[model samples]
Target: DPMVMAMLVDKMQEACQHLDRLQVRISDTRSSVLVTGDLNAGKSTFVNAILNREVVPDDQQPCTALFCEVKSVDQNDGVEEVHAIRDPEAYRRDDPTTFERLSLAHLRTVVEDNEPGYEMLKIYCRDAHGKSDSLLHNGALDISLIDSPGLNIDSMKTMALFAQQEEIDVIVFVVNAENHFTLSGREFLRTAGKEKAYLFIVVNRFDQIRRKDRCKRDVLDQIRDISPRTYAEAEHLVHFVSARKTLLNGLARSPSPMARGAMLEPASEADLADFKHLERCLRQFILEKRARSKLAPAHVYLSHLLSDLRVLLAYNAQRSARALQRLDGQRSQNEARALQLAKLRETVLDRLDDTIADTAQRVADDAERHLNRFLDHLHHIPYDVTYHGMMYLWRYADDLYRAITMRMNGLAAHIQTEAIRLSSAASSVSTVVAPPSSVSSSATTLAHRDTLGAGNVPALPELLDRAALARMARGLLPGLGALAVGLVGYARSLVAPMGAGAAASHALVTAAKRPNPLARGAFGTLAFAGTLMLFYVVADFRRPLEQQLCRAVGTHLRRTGWVRRHADATGRRAARALRQGLWRFQSDFARIQAEEAVLATQWSRERDACQQRGQRITAMTTRVAEITEQLEAINLDT
Candidate 1:
């Protein structure tokens, strides 16, 4: 983006600097006039008439092959000089000098040699009285008159040479009135007329026309038809002139007629008037054309600079829009990731909860079964008999304790496993939710339970002291009493309980008194076993032992509860971590959104500036067009 900004600034500066330089150059430029025509079109005669000297040769055959530059000299002595400039190689080969001074009378003879080295002919002439006083008489600025080769022989080459010159203020296209507009002449007009130059189409040799008025009208019509762009609606651009007549009149008025035989007939006033009108038109057009030419380059430079500015503005706007689009797309992605992380947190926590519930339930069921078996074994041991019975109960209690511990450990392991899984899930989600810099690699390490098997598991029997254990044992005494009462009622119902209570008591005593030996033995054994069971059930050893088993089972349940609690804690921690990560991501997204807002504001400002510049360019372009139109609409008026 900075690069783009730099490029935009550079382009703007470049265009502006170029326009400034062009304006400066245009301000100091000099105006020039190029005179061109077909072969034998009196172009040379026209130039000679303007200079009041035969600087350019007017012969039967084509004489001038190179461009001739006619400049006014500040020689009050009236001594005109003709200087010939030769090409370097040609001058080196034939003559050592690049410049050759020629006599004014022999200027045509030397230039007509058509030497290969001839580059240009410079004629420094002092204007004769009343001769050079017309048309090209600007006060200070010296307007050089350029005469080029005939367009018919090498029109492309000739036009190419003329096109190289700068600031062409006026173009005097001399065409023979007898031939009007030739194909080559009209083509040259089309090519040269497109330049920012005031065109004056002079029909030379007007004396050749038989019917002057009719021929003049026909010639003007022909000029309009042939070169409509040069003559269309600007009838003043077309002028009928007799350069030969004007030259003859100048010679006749000369102190010594240089060409005595050239003036066989005196020049008519009408012919003189035609020359004067042509001169006046040239003067008016040249003055205005020079003034407009000064502003032409400024107009062109503004147009070019405006065009470049518009293109640069469009490019910058497109780049800014693309950048904004990319930012918006990234913001959307961040938001989506945040939402996904949130969902993952919910899912992981729910799954951990389910795992904890299932595991806790299984461990609880196992502990309950172990406690039931221990209690049932205690019911079978006789209390009034041997010490071995007590030993057996203690041994069973120890086994139950071990079993409960193992189960609790297993439950802890399960919870740990679930915690690890939840942590892993959270870690995976973190990769997507948080940026790389914010993601913690050790986030899931809390799930590693290195202390579970190293005696850190909560022991069942150790949870309560002797007093607490004795209190819990006393708390179970009511349930034990109820069980003993129920057992006595079951024994009575099995013996006799169908009749009344007194009758059942009498029957039971009679059966005991008349017992046979085998019946006696069997009844005695049965009574002994029942009495032992009853005594054992009511012994203090059974109570204490039952309390021990209850403590072990309670301890196991507490341990499993710890596991569940750990699992819950782990789940909550992981969920909280995920939420925190998600929050960070959201925070980052918010920051990005804020940055985007700032960038958007900047983009809006740049767009406004671009729009304003575009509007200015449009206005300036319209102004340039108006100025161009005004320049084109300029004529001999203002």
Candidate 2:
């Protein structure tokens, strides 16, 4: 009675879970399930059979071309809650034309009418039946039956994300009666083993085996070969059903009552009898076991949640590392650019100073001598003539000085532009690592919600929303763009002063006239001497200017209170968000762990607890197998 009670309890618990899920679906909006298998495995047909309706569009290729979910709603019911699970795309759902661009000849294709449907590879969710509205309304079960493209050649990594989130409960395995044990089916079985539950192998096409001898012998042999392995798993179960037949029965289109059982609606006594068996298995084994299993506590759930969180954190870390690497590389490149800009600034400044020095020396050496000679003849001429000679020399010197200054300023302006470009590059690199501002905001929101206990504890089916994640990324774009542009503008402003002098010099040159050859030759000699003075004075001053600029920027960054406030706010927000997420996952895991621990402790307390069904079953079976092997060995020795 104790053994029976345990089994009964397990079954009852499973039933409750299914009922709870159903209730949630009825109350919640977005819920989904993912169904995957090898080619010709009857996965799609099985889904259609379950709903007692044909909702999934069928295909004949080795793989399913698209991913689809079936949703239902109550027309009369009001809008309830919606639970949507975020997952990675099976194929390229992000791309509108992934189907047209990629050759899926090697992959699964969901073909309708022998023609390929647009490769719509989005995740599928089945809504509870009853309503027509924009959002999932009606107190209907939200069960998304995710129909994945055939898993034949696709990498398991491609499909691993779905299961990692704990989204699947029941896996209906459809095996063709004709080829019950294909190699593909074997591999599929191996993958199923990694799952938390045992698989139900549905034997399709029972009607096709018309001959009694063939049906009896062939089916039995196949079952015998696979049964031992199937039975070994604690939570696994098997079933014999035909989806094609089930569909016909549901449609009321079957030719005979015997065939009607295949669809699910039994029309005959035998068909009804089989339905009872299937229902029994579902209720006794699958549904009940799930309910009876101990609920995990926050800590246990946390461990598992942490595993996923670790994965997410790892992905983000990798992205950040790459971004930082790119930024560093860009910084290196910009350093070179900045260096080039600095050199240009120097060249322009030096050129302006050289021109001024050269012009001044020329005037001092040649113009001064000429003026002195003219002065020697000053007494011979009238006072007005002497004054005119002095005026001419002075006028020429001023004109030359202005000309040199103008040229220098123009060169300086060009250098300023380059500096702006370099500065822009630096700014872009600095802000590159910042997650979109919306990401920060969303993270903060999650934290705030945690404080309010939004996603904490045993956790709701709505753990993480993919749409929210995308929105957060979208929100951060504008700020980053502005930062990039501002850096470039700032670089140019730094060099604007140098250009000013050059422009003034050029303007003066435009106003001046020609000089005598002897005077020009003397001026050139004097100009060379003045060049040394300009470099010593103006060129040496740049180091101090650069230091002052750097200090100002650093001080401004420190003094601005807004940056600190935002950072503190964001940190508090992230801590809260992380805790909430951790709490939700751990609560479930902890509950389960606590239950398991209690069971373990109870087993220690009672000697009979060690005598579990699984152990007993395994030992008994092992002895039987060993006896058989010993018999064969004795016969061989004889």
Candidate 3:
């Protein structure tokens, strides 16, 4: 089953070449079988037992100090072989002076960086060194073994990495029989079981406790209470063994019979039987894992991968928003304005084109004759008519620039005047109302602006208030007033549907009883007072919306005249300066070249004399600074 899954992972890794290969390093190859536990909880020993090997290095030290991988290797002619993955130690070395290349090589290398004391698990084992030529024979099942660093204090990195790779095939948790259950151990089990891996609770060195009366059984029961998942999985499958003894027995079995006397554990028959049973159970569990792997292919994990990807997308989006917030929000407003201007230009083409054509023709006609007369006179001169022609060009350019600027300023003023006229007409029905205090400064600026003796200025008529403008708009569009009335009545009905009718009936009855024409008119207005209240409510809500519309219209008006003029002025200035400078430089070409030759000769002579000092550039700078300081002090004294 592992074979099938491994093949699938291989194909996926091949297809994802466009993405950086580093993404594949963690999840590629095969499902990692993370063998983790306490220092002497038989993690390394358990790995060796499952692989049927006596090669994993083991010691009695608190930290065993190496992360090893026993993977299938390849030989010529389709022979299957096991090879130990080797690379530089990915840990803090005894010699701490050099740390430049402390970790293992990059992800592409055989062994990845798994620095000791860091809560990461790293072991990459492949059967072959190259691509799989034959999926049947030469193809070797690849399995990553994650031997985690000690877990006295939970490392956030370790927790995150484990959470990321929650598709673990099997969790081999080794518990030492002698030690009591610890908080760290319980925490590890709780997290490990939740990952949905097949849990295996192994009691290492069970031979020491198996002989005591109910001692081994008591410890096993405690483990069951602590790890329900592990206990359930082990109901039909649990292993207890002295790994060191097993390793020695398997390796030294064919050795001289006397050499076997020094086995790591007691030489009791029961100890031998325990080790043998433990070995069989461990083998069966691995087989079960392999079977599961075959039953569910690698695509089964794609759903989890996609889920993690969505979370990552959300994280990145938030990160970008925060980054932009730090960069200054004013730029965002400028960008939005630019986009709006672009969209408006597409719809306002005919108006913009006509304006541009009119401005260009008028400006050119006004300046052309003056420029031609000057050029004609210059051509008659004998000493380089080209120079005179250039001067004529510069003057003509300046005249054109001035005419264009005037046209643009005139256009902008005309647009603003028309806008004010429309605003005036809308507000012509009632007396003027003062604008809000917040707009007082703008109002003052408008009042003080000098208007020429023309009919463009708006008269300060009585009907200049918001209410007057609304009434005028209603006269222009009948349904607009009706819509306002309906919306208000709808909202009122929601609040007091029955009481609203009673109030209306009372007002109508009072209006019907009125006799005098003026009094009847007053009563009729009073009868519709509720409707006026609703109209005011809608009017107040529409103020902000009106301001936005006015602003947008004003921006379009400003761009129509201001932007064209600005572009024209800029282009004219650049053209004029270049033409004039080119003319002047050519007219005095000989004289300027003669002067530059003299200056160059003098500069070279001084430079040669200074070069004899042979001082370093840095020293010369220091000396100059020192001299400047002394000179400053002398000036101060004087």
Candidate 4:
């Protein structure tokens, strides 16, 4: 696309260059008349006859290889000077950078030498005609004549280039009366006709052509075929003259290709009269018909320039329009994508919140239900805890409490781990909650981030409190409450203490046969009380102790809400870890959305720029169209 744009710029530059040259040409009222013909067809002679000076040299060989422009000295501040222009487009009469100043005396040598590099030569000289005698003296317009190289097969293209210049108001196609129109002459006329269709056709050396009528007819016939429009106005546009006679009466005599003779008395006056008439007609054509002569060439060139520029501008406009369209589409798409990403991140985070809360509730409920069931099952499992007599029953109670604590702790751990996996599964639909892109493989990335690391995953909250353990251990003995009073009373009033103590008490009673009854009763009661205290210290009520310990543990766990509290803690901890990951995802997602928004802004600007470019292209195209329309109107009016 850049290459295409560059190419368009280059073409526009060329158009601008052409406009520059046109500005220079139309800047003044001076009209340029080009005298071009076949090789040595007296083109230089005709130019001299017009200026009435031989400043432009004529040679047997191709002398005027380059364009030799002749200007009156009065136009150059009344000074005679010559300039050789190397680059005509940049040529300025006073600018040293543009042209090389030459000696006026060497005008003949400069014109005849035909320098290799220079394409244009300017000659400023004093013409032979005085103020009222010449059109150059007219205040209305300034006129200059250019003598071009003789038309040849090799130089035809170059001559064509010169003749079609924007300032060339008139074309003088001088034909040698003896030879008529040569192939080169015909070809030049045919091509030049496209712009300057009406040319001043001059048949020079007419006096030497004895068969003048046939020569005139033959030239007119060639004119009709080359330019019918010019031939139709032959009386005004065509002429037959003796440039040699005019020349003999004009500049210095120099040996040339054409043979020279003494002035003959017979046709001298006729030749002079005809040459004079040609001069008069040329002046009238330049002054009276200045509009067609001056403006037509420029109009022709301007029309073509506008046509080319129109094509170029129209092409650029279409491309700009399409570019604007594409930019709009891309900008819109980026904006929509940014919006979508924003919404998706919010939705994912919301779902994660619900999942975490729901998981905590489920974990709490499962822990409460499963733990209570285990305690209930313990009521029917008496054979498992071996009752090693009522003496070691208290040891057995300690063992039972330890066993329940370990089982509950293990179950709480299992509940925590199960909560992690199920919570992860519940929120699996939200992939954005995954890790912070640190996982090496996709397989583990989701599972890894949704749950905590292995070290933290299966950890249970503290489940078994010391208070519950102490309560269960104390269950193997009687309470220090009113239950202790009832046990001692039952031992004192209802049961014998021990068989040895009873036999000892009987022997003592037999020895002191009729001692005091109060004393005897008191002794027997003290022995019984002592025995009861020792027996109660090591009671072996295994079945009742086991049930009581299990009941206390279950009661402690429920009353304190121990299992549910720990399970909820575990679930909430896992949720916080997952929520943190989701927060990271939200940050990353928002960053991406922000970047996309920036891109969309840039695209929108570019789209606006393209639209403005299309508008500019349209403006340029319109200007060109207006210029073309004006030229057409002028041509029609002319």
- Write model 1 residue lDDT over 511-534, tens digit each, in one string: 656544554445455555556654
Flag clash pairs in model 3: 1-294, 72-127, 73-127, 427-463, 430-462, 430-463, 431-462
Model 3 earns a TM-score of 0.34
Clashing pairs in 1: none
Q: What ranking emerges by lDDT with the best candidate at the front?
A: 4, 1, 3, 2
Per-residue lDDT over 512-606 for candidate 2, one digit per residue giving the tens place of the 0 to 100 score: 33324554444444444344443443333322222222233223333553224333443344444333433343354445446655654553444
Cα lDDT of model 4 by residue, 1-638, tens digit:
89987997897797687667667766767888888787778888787777676678776566777788888777778878888887888988777888888876777776666555677888888767876666555666777888887767255546555546434678888888888898767776777776665789899878877888988888888889999978987888899997867877654355533334544433467777888888877877777777667666566667776887788788888889888878877877776766666666666655657755676566556655665676678667544456577658557766776665555555655655565565565455445423342211221122321222222222111222366445545643433433455445544544333446767778666645644556445545655555565456446455556666666666655576654555555556556655654555667666766777678778878877887888889888888888878777785224
Poorest lDDT segment (10 consecutive residues) of candidate 3: 430-439
Higher-ranked by TM-score: 2 or 4: 4
Candidate 3 lDDT over residue span 396-417, tens digit each: 3333333323333444344333
Clashing pairs in 4: 390-540
Clashes of each: 0, 88, 7, 1
TM-score, each model?
0.51, 0.30, 0.34, 0.55
Please name the candidate that would achieve the greatest TM-score relative to the true structure.
4
Q: What CA RMSD would you report for each candidate? A: 12.7, 39.7, 38.5, 13.1
Task: Give lDDT: candidate 2, residue 382.
Answer: 22
- Ranked by lDDT, the better of candidates 2 and 3 is 3
